[model samples]
Target: MDQISLALLSVFFLLVSIVWYSWIFKNWTKKLPPGPRGVPILGYLPFLSHNLHIQLTDLARKYGPIYKLWLGTKLCVVISSPSLIKEVVRDHDAVFANHDPTVAGLVATGGVDIVNSPYGPHWRNLRKVFVREMLSNKNLDDSGPLRRYEVRRAVRNLYGKIGTNVDVGELIFITEVNVVLCLIWGGALEGENRDKIGARFREKVAKFVELLGKPNLSDFFPILAKFDFQGIEKEMKGVLPSVDEILNSVISDRMKIMEDSGGEFSSANRRKDFVQILLDLMKQNDIVIGGTDTTATIVEWVMAELLQSPHAMQKAQQELTQVVGLNNIVEESHITKLHYLDAVIRETFRLHPPLPLLIPKMPSKSCTIGGYTVPEGSRVLLNVWTNYKDPQVWENPTEFKPERFLNDDDNGKWDYIGNNFHYLPFGSGRRVCPGIPLAERMVTYLVATLLHSFDWKVPEGVKLDMEEKFGIVMKKSTPLLAVPYQRLPSLDMYE
Candidate 1:
């Protein structure tokens, strides 16, 4: 038995050596980063785990912060450290400005839209419309009333559910969905119709985001994409039509309203970017999905973290009570003055980055990062999750401590502009989230209102689950279910 086992072990080592040397020799001239070798047909594909983000971060431990792995035929590189991230997002921004979308992603966006558009004029135009028009300071400020209406509705609705368990994620999802629809097409759909549309959009978005993260054989083995062995593409394509129906209805309604009002309802007369956003269905679709889900997931997470850490929750509530006051409801105007609450939001972002790996970037050309040659079009995953939780970067990295950010505040050093590589919750670069203006006000105000108007309590002594389920957008695996009771001075304030 011993003799046969020894001989087989020797043979296995010999075979692995042959494969490893073959891979090295094939790309010897490029000087690629070192990585594990896999079977001939599926290179490191079978070995990939469900949570790709966590798996890649773990891989960084064995290999350096920046290393490469072959996913079937795709050469995927992962960057974990801040210095390497700085190189990719900052120094070589243009070279890696392009997005490397998955097959499901391509089907979802139709290869057009600001998030997944090719790095060129078309993308620039979309960004221009998005930034200079759709999300301008003036447009966002004017739209404050729209957002306020939806968020306050949620607060009042929760007030009605006093002492009863409520699903926080569902509550926030519906509110954000309605808020985005308001901005997308003001008063276009309302009453039972708006509620019906929101329900459909919520289902479609959950399916789409789930598909976006699923490992497609087509992505790893491009040749298999047409076949769609997993049917991921078909399912993704199926998801879009329902979304299009919703978008189409909104467009048709808005157009009818315009004609009825003698064309006074044009972008020029109102939001100023409706026409541009309407022209591209995918752009509007991305906005709806990205806008609703990211904000809701973040709000749920902040609540979960605060629930578990009573000290942080009490401190945040105390700050909110002092700043926002019991006589008035939480408002966007109160966001800046709630410094401790701001720290709590920053701390939550640090812990639960909305997009764990900010939309994978593909280099426009072969480039060098961390001194290793990253080939053109290779899927380069920026492991920002690792950077956020790195021991060297933060003290007690895994612990939930908001005070860490407040202790060393210096001239906007910890802002979300992605300037601070150590903490880019929304992301950073030429393609930094254009919706920042709206997201900041929405996320902060929602959390502030909930905390200020009512005190949150976890269901019946159950421990709050902080476990995360990773996708392109990371969310709490277990949805937060809690009760809320009035903390304000009067019920009239809610009205």
Candidate 2:
């Protein structure tokens, strides 16, 4: 009986050894992309940097455009070059259509929401509703007044502090919050109450965003996520309730108003405005954050870059003066006509895309990119930042040059839609950002309003700080502090 038991144990060990070696051998022969091999079990997790985009780009330089790295048990493939990017996002796009949500991501969005949802029938349905109801051109145009009102309010507020310094990012952020929040629900939040809650809500949302980028062991080794080794998931849960509480309160107040008003505010033909509403999808932290953060950050970057490059700033102002004139205020309609301003926007995007890595795409099956096998479920990060700054793609890439976008050689080439692989600020294929129309309009209009309304310059000895703080949303290390004075013809124009 002892000999029989010993024989069974030996057979089990032998089977395990063979399977493990076979798996290793298979991966070795699969033509996987080259990358640094880290310590056993932990893989390259220990070596990652806080500025994930810059760190990945540095690795790409050493390992070529396509490279792989292991973060714990997970495989991360970084795609940097344009040609290789096309392979994954266009050629084999279907295979990489899915998103591999991080442990923190799944918690914040609960495996739901359009941004983090797995690509499938359900996601497709959500996208359909999002595009149709929220982002369609008609919907955007109908809601233009709401956006314009917010911008005008911002302009007025800045006018009050004509000589005083203002935080460009914070002001734009608060304004955007109002636009998205008020547009989605309505006058549910009004007067002084809205102002107090809006400021507090921004802090809560910012806190949630800060947590998402924190290094989480659960993200790298998700199998043990339930153990909450790092407590990131637990912390994320703690954050969500606060965010949900604000959202629910706003929505609940709106619903009560509708009920008390005999559903007058819930009219079927109602425009999405400060007073009109209807939509049960009230857990809109994702929408509000996405809409506000990216747009506001870009505006801040645009202003920072312009401040650094006086020539560009003068040119933009010159064009604005010609297009909008001194007597008039910046209207959304004026945004399209401001050619130099458009180039400035593209330049800023090229230099500093809000989502530097874009939302990471995960493949459904093993696929080949640049002759290397990217195994199924690998976290594929499309390095838009690297592509944007590649000297091969841009002339003097690191230099802040808005004219590169306006060059006639690439006439009609540098568009927001990612058709020309080299310039993809908004990404490409099916999963491209659906909010481009709204985003482009908002950022352009807001920047145009600021530029057209005020001649901005950093205070003496401020050094025009453009240092970036890396996060899910790239923020100015120091929020832009510039003095604004009346550039418009009259104060009534602001009103």
Candidate 3:
């Protein structure tokens, strides 16, 4: 045969072999979960809505609680049922402990940060640093003055702008960013440079968050990753340098201090800031990203819910008045006593989880969930939003009713700690968000202070809009613009 005929024969044999191989495996391979049919190549990508959580929930109604989809060549399975979620996150936790980092995630974290790192000794070390060394109760308590200072500063700023429109989300984001910066390196920077660094860090971090969540063709199609069809990865790389520059400067300055101080920088004389502790450990990207974005996003969501539901707002205020008293400002010690405020926060999480689909997981090995075999390396999404709003699981799931969580029975049933499968706002299992303790403290304290110090209402002639915009974090589509009035008896409280 001629060369052209030989090439054609080779191609035919390859195709035949692939078909025969697939056929032979089909009989023994476990069945995949049910899902909607899709067009070839593109799969379900075309049908996806910008608000993916809502669209996926709608699909769940048709395909049952557990379903699968193909985004480009990637296989994705979404689980909305509590039982199935428990199986993946609890029963077989080790099997699905690995994360399937997106293109932006890999680029942003360099695949080493706790959020994206695979489950193993490295991840364990990082978690230990975060839990025992950095975010320990002693550490958080030591940083209380810093958190209080930032929150009070924000209150004073808003008090000055009372009766005028204020973007609540922006205000809270700035406050949370400053607070996180303080927690990270409050003792490192001083005076004007502190403000400048906080502002610069905020600007860069915002860009980083946007780039991380923006849809990328590379994420869905691994073959096209190097090409970066959408330029998302390239843009992420551009933003990453600014963030790294800041982290490197902080690390270098701290290391120099340690070196110059010689033996004086021993454990007994160590600083309380997280940056000092993490100077010799891993990079601070995970701490910065997790500490700032998630806390700020949830605070914004809770404020939005409270603004939309006046009764809920009044109830929270009353609780604050009773617990902390109008004469006294909110303190970290008071958070535990404010049960109603805690319930309101829980209700907000139910309605709008910061990560609707908790960081996607990858099966380290083939596993069974809900009796269907989930192939190794397939992307698994835990739809916390859908599960939280399941009508069978919650009464009036769409309604913003904090009272539902007021009862001890309900409080025991749901929490951010990821115990109960039905309500996993902070996620569940081995890879569950390690920032939960810090998140709860920051969110509750901020919300309590905001509500106790001021009364907020939608601007005159304006209506509250709770429409959600989907991204890595769920945000209010229209930034909440509200007018604040001093609720405290004395202006001294603002100071």
Candidate 4:
């Protein structure tokens, strides 16, 4: 053969050999589990729907609750059945407690924040600091006056909107944000400070949610993970610095207050809000970025759901009236007495969990769940949304029925606290939401207070749409718009 021909042949053979080796190695790694077949390199990335959770849910209906899918260099096992979900999140929680170390999560969590930190000494120490400083019942009680004050303000603001149509979602967000911000800051904003603080918070939160929730094709296609395929990087880069500044400034301001007045009254007896406690812990190298973010989202979703379900709203109102009485305003202390209201909140959470799939839970060690071997370091999803809607455990799971939880015997003596895999709104095991007690009180208080304060109705000629779109939380498909009519001046609130 000619020299030129021999050279070309040598090059072609090398190329063929490389491709053959790559293909063989890919299949060798592909022996994990059953899932939709994918093209080389992409590995289900192309077939992935925009809303991955919904797509996974539909796939679960056909593939069974426990199935596998490949995301880039990672193998993910999704747990959709309550029984298996319970096994992973409750029975064997330690093995599945790590947070997936995606680029965005690392950037947001500061590599040490409690939410994304791996389950270890650092997480344990941070949890101790959190539980002692912020999550304690004393702290919750200390913050009660602030919460009640905000609730009163929110109730009054809603009352002012009587006879007029307003975006109830936005209004509720504003109210909830004020409550959280007040709990973070020393007190609620007033006049121009209110607008400024509210605007800054809204802007920061919107930017964060938008940047965090978008599809990171890179997450599934590791080769392209740096591509920031959806402009998430560009948006986050522009927004995060400003967000960090806002948070840091708040922290610094609180520290300055502590420095200026060296006394227990300033550091100890002073009103300790969530931010102040976090600030104190920041001195010990502990902090969290998504704390306020999740709180805001949960409150937003609860309102969105309640606004859409008027029957649920009416029932909650009836319960509030019975317990709180027609002449008295609902308070946080009244929540336990309002059993129906609590059930309604639980039902809402079931239908629309704040974190539908939950921040991905990673396994620290290899484990078998539902007959599928999940290798160590696999990204695991609890599939809270699917579990809550499972027909096997819940009768007519899709329907909104608060009564299902009204009594332990209603669903044959179902115990919600430890319902195995059937329901997990706040997750399970050691990782169950530390904020549940606070979140529950806040939700029940606002819900009961609103029901007692006004009569909300779908605006004339407008129907409530229950469609949902997921962000940080699953939000209503349409912004909930309601025309609340003023009722008789019966709910007597304190000054």
Backbone clashes in each candidate structure, one number apiece? 0, 1, 0, 2
Better of 3 and 4 by TM-score: 3
Residue pairs clashing in model 2 are 187-274
Q: Which ranking of candidates, highest TM-score first?
A: 1, 3, 2, 4
Residue 115's C-alpha lDDT in candidate 2? 82
Give the candidate order by descending lDDT. Answer: 1, 3, 2, 4
Q: Write the per-residue lDDT of candidate 3 for residues 1-495, one digit (tens) a residue.
A: 999999987885566455534532662457888898776556788888999999999999999888998786677899988889999999999999999988988988878888888899998988887889778888888888889888998998898999999987778877887787766665566557866777787778778878877877787767568888788888888988888887887778767767878835656336467776676465758788778877778888898888888898999999999999988999999999999899899888888888999888999998888888788888998888888787787898889888888886565778778899888888888888888888889999999999999998889899888889898888778878889998999989999
- The regions of model 4 sitting more than 4 angstroms off are 1-31, 226-229, 266-269, 283-311, 410-419, 490-495
lDDT of each: 0.84, 0.81, 0.83, 0.69
Which regions of candidate 1 deviate over 4 angstroms?
A: 1-26, 266-276, 280-283
**lDDT, candidate 1, 73-115, per-residue tens:** 6888889888899999999999999999999988888788778
Best-performing candidate as measured by lDDT: 1
TM-score of each: 0.92, 0.91, 0.92, 0.87
Give the true-structure RMSD of model 1. 5.4
lDDT minimum window of 10 residues, candidate 4: 283-292
Instruction: Give the residue spans of candidate 2 off by over 4 A.
Output: 1-26, 257-269, 273-282
